[model samples]
Target: MKVFEPVVRLMNRLKYAQKFIVIAVVFVLVIASVSFILMQRMNSEITEMEQRYEGASYNTALKDVLQQVQIHRGTSVQAWNGSEDAQSKLASIREQANRALHVLNEQHTKQTYPLHIDEELDAINEQWQAIAEKDRWQDRDELTTLHTNLTTFIIETMLTVSNESSLQLARSPASQNLIATLTKTMPSVTENAGNLRWLGASVLAKEGDMTAQERAHISEKFYLMIEEFATIDADLQRAFTDPDIQAAVQSTYEEATAANELYATMVEQLLNGETANLTSAAFFEAATNTINLQFDLYSTSLAHLTTLMEQQLSELKMNRIMLVLLETLIVLVAMYLFMGFYIGIKRSITTIEQAAISIAEGDLTTSIHLHTKDEMLEIEHAFNKMTTGLQSLVKEIGESSQYVTASSEELHVGVEETTKSIMHVAEMMSDVSEGANEQTARLQQSEDALQHMTNDVAQIVTNSEDVAQLALTTMTLAHDGNDVMQQSSTQMNTIQQSVETTQHMIEALHGRSEQITHILQLITGVAEQTNLLSLNASIEAARAGEYGKGFAVVANEVGKLAAEARNAAHEVGTLVQGIQKDTTTSVQLMGDVTTQVRTGMDLSTTTAQKFEQIVSSMEQLSEQINGIIVNSSQVASSTEQVVTAIDAMKVISTKNMAASTEVATATEQQNASMEEMAASATELATMSETLQTLIQRFKV
Candidate 1:
């Protein structure tokens, strides 16, 4: 992570386009650089192997020339020494050698060789041509010398070609040394072994005691052949040490050495002055066998070397192919990772941009979401927190605002209803006042009628004057007082009935308040449901993505508004409960006022019953006018009690007035309280509207 910190910082500073460009440039540079190095190496390897392979063909051409020339050497020696079979074979063998020379010449013409090897090849070919052109037999030793010299040139050319073409070189030590043995060491051994064959056959053909110079030549060739075999053996030993060397190389080499040892034993006869047992042909045959086996070793080694080079060339080609593919894969993978990272970063940035824009537009309900597991996830979380808090605060403010508006309206309506009730109660109080005054006047009339009755009774008792007229007057006044008292009772009863009806109406209003409160609760529940539905819509729209982005935003705003509405409904429900409580209190107060009205009605009824008794007493007084004259003092006492009853009625009427005044005062206070509540509600409503105006700025 720390290793990538610089890249991270650079990437953070760069825009997405700049980052993409940087990554693309770096990717191309790295891949191109690595590919160039590997391709150069592979090309060099392929070229070297191809050259070596091409040189193998030249070497084979040289080997063909060497083969015929080696045979040519032996036949020339035999023919010069007077072997009829050798003389017969000599011309055809020369032709074969010449044909091989022609083929090698053709090969040389097609491709240029190294200056040294090419010159050596031309000289070798010219010497072979000169030898083939000489048809007449020369001295045996001279002819052998010509053939030996030409064959030596051919072998040398082969070695030069091997060296020039890098056939003697290989990748590993064992293989390198092995190829050296085949191309350089084994070729020399085979040629020297051919030398022994010819020299020894010449000695056998002479059939005389070997001359000192000839014997010396035979001794040197035999030992040189032995020494070269030793060198080849050592080289082969080294080659076999490699684990990968063929087991057949060791087996074939052992067979060649066996043949060489046999030939060495035969050559000992020519060296030790025992030429009787060995004929020229037998000596030649034995020596040729040794050369052939040595040639077999050369051939096997060459094949192995060629195979090794081919495998090396194949491996190099495969490596080049693999390197190309690997480079391609590296490029593809690098591009994939960079593009994925780029796309991921781009997507994250887009998301952040959208969320920020939404917030800028006052859409607090828009929450940030990210799918990638990166630093952007932290940013998304932070954004979500910010939006969620803002949304909650706005929702609370809106809810409070709507609650205030509703409460204000409810308060205003309550004030109006309460003011009307106060006015109705005031009208009822005015009626009670008039009824009280009417009752007071009636009481005064009864007092005057009693005064007249007393005067009439005094006249009847003192002067025995008009007893029947006084009795009739007393009865008529009693009837009139009874009727007035009944009228007063009827008015009082009407007041009591009005109070009971007002109480019942107030109670009914309380019941209606309770029902209204229940309906408000239902509306509050509906608001909550609306909030829930908005939330569900928002969820669905979020799931819908591109198709529903606008819908999701709308739903989110709706959900917030619904939350506000639900809260407002709850607050209004609370206000309605308060109103309900007030209504219940008003009903209770009306009950109390109704009870007072009933008490006043009972007092009026008692006064009416007293008048009825006074009327009955008047009826009995007609029969007893004398008795009426004597009980006139009792009547005056009864009139005094009646006046005391009227005073009590006046006191009841005063209390009713005072009670009515208290009721009016209380209603006024309630009205004023409602008025204050309405003012507060209006102010709250204004604040609600202000909050709503601000909230509307946010789309969600």
Candidate 2:
């Protein structure tokens, strides 16, 4: 850096034309360099965007593959679990699987197929054909294991493709989450649902005959489901960080969550040994719906991500186009300015040349003129100025010699007048010396008195300033007290509101207690009516003598219960009355408290207003004290200025007396200078002749 410092110094010494070429060259280099960088970046981005679009397509295809395989596997197991139309359902699912497989192969061919996705998919297909072989299918456990392995390979291949594509390294963070939901998380979630489908179908078909192994299978699936439930939420939440993506997938996410919840409830019931209540077909249908909803979520996320990448690709292309346009426009504008600068330089140079040749031939009137709005115009200005200065210098030199001759003549006449005036001033000087000493002595006495008065005024100003400071401090304290009073007023208001609220509550409680007492009274009346009816029934039965004994026993028990009911009702009425009385008393006390709180609030508010008034009055008092301090300060300052002026005037008077004596002594010397002035006049005339010959050489 220190070595570069000398280079910087050398650069600063470069001519303006050299600096312009340096700047133009740097501008071209910068434009080229930036354009090259931007082009390369755009090319990279376009290529990545195309790759991500392919990845999204591939992800969709793989998801469909999982959906088909999972569906067909569940259907085949459901058929094995005694589902109706076993062969037809398997054939239908097989056809759909074949179609999805065709699309998946096509998408696979579009990509480079890293991670041997081609061979792995073939292996999965071969295994899927093997699993779907119903004649070879043994138990649900063996079939589930086979289907799980096939789907697991498909998911792993999807993840590998994800890593190889732009999805794993997305420029937008939302894209990463969206891609994950399509690739890894949702695939695993659907696979677990698939596992539940086969296991649950067989278990529900068997009803209560599910073995411990079946329950353990259901529990493990549920455990994985629980973990996935949390992961899907976290992934979607991260994906929703972008507003546009959130809006795109919000509907599918809700539907998927609802379906997952429904399926989870069914799975939980099965795990809890409640499978006898669920039919095999219903359980299979619920699992299928859960799997379909998860796929929907995957599809929605992928489509929106694809749309975003397409837009990004378009924007990058447009940016590249704009960059080219901008660079070309800059070059055009730079060329325009460069041409203008060259033309201005040419005009300025031509003007300078003509002016220079004229000046070289002894023409002082030669001058350059320009109106360029550039640095080259400065040269025009400088050239014209030099010629004008030269012309003016010659004219001034010619006139200066004549002025010298005339001044010498004037000086000789001025000396005689000065000798006369000096003799007259000497007479006045003696009189002035007497008055000057007396004025100086009086000024000194006045200054001493002013100094004492100034000190007293200054002390008064200081005391007034201290009083003003105290008043300002008091004003601040009054404002603080006002704030405290305001807060107290607000608190009292809050308390008043609370008291009123409590009073209303107590009044309601008292009313409710009175209503309870009425209800208790009604219960006592009803018990009496029942006792009367029971006695009437016993009398009627006695007329039929054999039935009378049974009727009499019943009536006696009924009467006893009625009597107890009446006694309890009476006791309850007594308690209700007590509660009513207490509540009424509480309500009345609360009313009194409310009134007191309101009064306190009013008083506090009034006191706060008074505090504000006190603060205002203190502020006015502080301002009045400040005004008095300012007046006292002004009085002290004026007294100091008067004292200083008197001291300066005294010094001036003493100097004037000395100057008068010096003037009288110089008058004799002026009488001798009259002869010298005559001799200088002779020399000035000779210099004037020489200056006239020099001025004749210039045209000015």
Candidate 3:
């Protein structure tokens, strides 16, 4: 089979690229799945942390402390006049202050450090107890000194608490300034409150010396100054004693100290006035401002902290946005890399697919050439080698086929020549058989004429004895005729010589025909053997296939020649039988003629013995002579019949010769036809070989 170069080449090209595509696809899928899962888990943790920072429990603790400080300032003013309303208000202030202090103490108990400002606040409460003891009983001048002292005490005490708060709220510059300014202004506020009280007492004593209008004007101015001082003092007191204020201050102090300690700890946390710190006073102050920013300088601190929390939240949001952007960029880069790998793999697969298709279509010359130093390149090399081997094998097969064709042609020619020789031998045998048939016919005729002559002589001897008896009768009549005896003797002598010459001619013809018959038998046997040889040649010719078609034709001609020879042998046998019948008839006719001649001889001898009695036998002797003449004439007619049969036998022999010549000519013509057929068969075989050669170009 011829291999197509294109098909083999195509097969070689596809084998390497397939493996690369499979590995690249699997790698991309695995990497993408893991990345997606990790990003999702991180996002969930971020959401949970944000919710904890925004809860409301921290908001409520800041408001309660500010309300209690407001109540205590109101009660102290009423206690100085000694009114029942003043005492009741004073008791209420004491109870609420105690409650507020207990709450502050509870907050401090949970702290890691002490808040020293709580001791200053406790001393201020003891001064309110001194105002309760001497209410309305003391003289004006004495009352004046007590009022001045109480006011001074309240001023100094609040200044000390504010200074302490200033140290704790140090992280924010605004909270530090608010704490320092309140401490500096406290002494002036205390001195002015004392001047207003003294003015009010003087105006009440001098009302008789002035006009009503003048007294009213002085009195109203004095009262107005006193109200302004009281209002300032009450606000200060409220801010100080307020539970939210204390808690904010206490929580701030604890966190500030914790931070200082944390600086030396393994990890540090931001302190109280550090904006947006979760566990700090600034954290609680931002919550407290939402409730109590009406009268206190603490409101400024609350606003500043609120501003800082907003900025921190905004920055955190921006950081989250930047992280998301970075993650997106990384994913995009990974996707691009994956896409490049996929495209490269797909291109290789396409090349291989094309090569495979070409190979299937019978293009064996193409090669799978690859540049990579990988398994695919190795496969390509092997594929190329396979195609090279196939090309060589196909070429060798074509050469061997041509050699076989030439050898077959030579064998066919030899077989044809052998067949022709066998045919020639058969023709020669037929000619010989025809000649033998003619010879056998001539022999039969000769034998028949000889037998006739012998039978005729025996009949003549029998008649001679009859004639001797007749002579005795003639002697009895011898006294009557002597002329009759002389004529009879002459006739008998002529008849005897004719019978002896006829016998000699018959013997010569028989001997010549017997020799011809022996030769004919020899020729018949030779023809039969020749026929057998021709048959064998035909069998060999038939075995030679298309190459020996010429020889087969010649073998057929030989078979025909052999059949002709067989016919010739049968014709000769039939002619020999006819001749034997004719010879028997001729022998019977000669026997009759010979017998008459002998009888005539006997009549002549008897007549000579009876010569003395001739006078009496002369008339009988003339009759006997007439009988001898009749017998001699019959013998001559039989000899003419024998000569005519010999002439007929010679004509049959001539016809047999013509038939043999025609057979010989026909055999020669058959041999020529076989030669022509052999030539034609050779031409056909050559044509077939040429066709085969042309077909070899198509590699199969």
Predictions in order: lDDT: 0.70, 0.66, 0.40
lDDT of candidate 1 over 1-700, digit per residue (tens): 8999998999999889898988799879977987898798789878778677667777767777777788888877777777899889988887887787788878777764442566787688778778888877557666767877877777777777777777666778888778777677666776777777777887777784577887788788778888888888888888888866757587788888899888988888678877778888998998888887777777777767777778888999999899889889988898898888888888888987787676656676787678868888887776676566556645654564566457546645754565566457556655655665665576567656656655665666665567666667767877887787788678777767766665565555456446545545654564565466557656655543454465466557656655665565566556556655655665666566566657656766776776677677778777766676667667666666666666666666566555555545554554454455445445545544654676677654
Q: Rank the candidates by TM-score, best first.
A: 1, 2, 3
Estimate candidate 1's alpha-carbon lDDT, on a 0 to 1 scale. 0.70
Error of 1 at 37 (Å): 1.8
Q: Is candidate 1 or candidate 2 better by lDDT?
A: 1
Tens-place lDDT digits, model 2, residues 1-700? 8989976886789865786777788888988898899889888887777777787788778888889988877877777666677646888888888888889877777664353466777886787677656465667667767878888888887887777675777777777876766777888989888888888888777765778887887789888987897799898899899999899999989998999999999988887777666888888889989899888888888888888888888998888888889999998899789878867776677776666656545476876677776775776676666566656644554454344335433433443343343334334434444444554555455466556556656665666546555555545655665665566555555555655654565565555555555555655665566456456545543542442354355445555555655665565556556555555655665565555555555555655665576566666765566565655565556556656655654565455345434433432333233233223333333433443454466578
Which ranges of candidate 1 are over 4 A from the true structure?
1-14, 102-116, 137-142, 389-695
- TM-score, cand. 1: 0.56
Tell how far residue 403 is off in model 3, in angstroms. Answer: 1.2
* 178-263: candidate 3 lDDT, tens digit per residue: 33333443233324322322332233223223346544543463344345434534443454454443444444334433432332
Q: In model 1, which residue pairs have backbone atoms overlapping below 3 Å?
A: none
Better of 1 and 2 by TM-score: 1
Give Cα distance to truth, residue 484, candidate 3, Å.
50
Q: What lDDT does candidate 2 reach at residue 308? A: 85
The clash numbers for all candidates, in the given order, read: 0, 0, 52
Instruction: Give the Cα-based TM-score of candidate 2 against the true structure.
Output: 0.50
- lDDT leader: 1
Stretches of candidate 3 exceeding 4 Å from the true structure: 1-33, 56-364, 422-426, 429-700
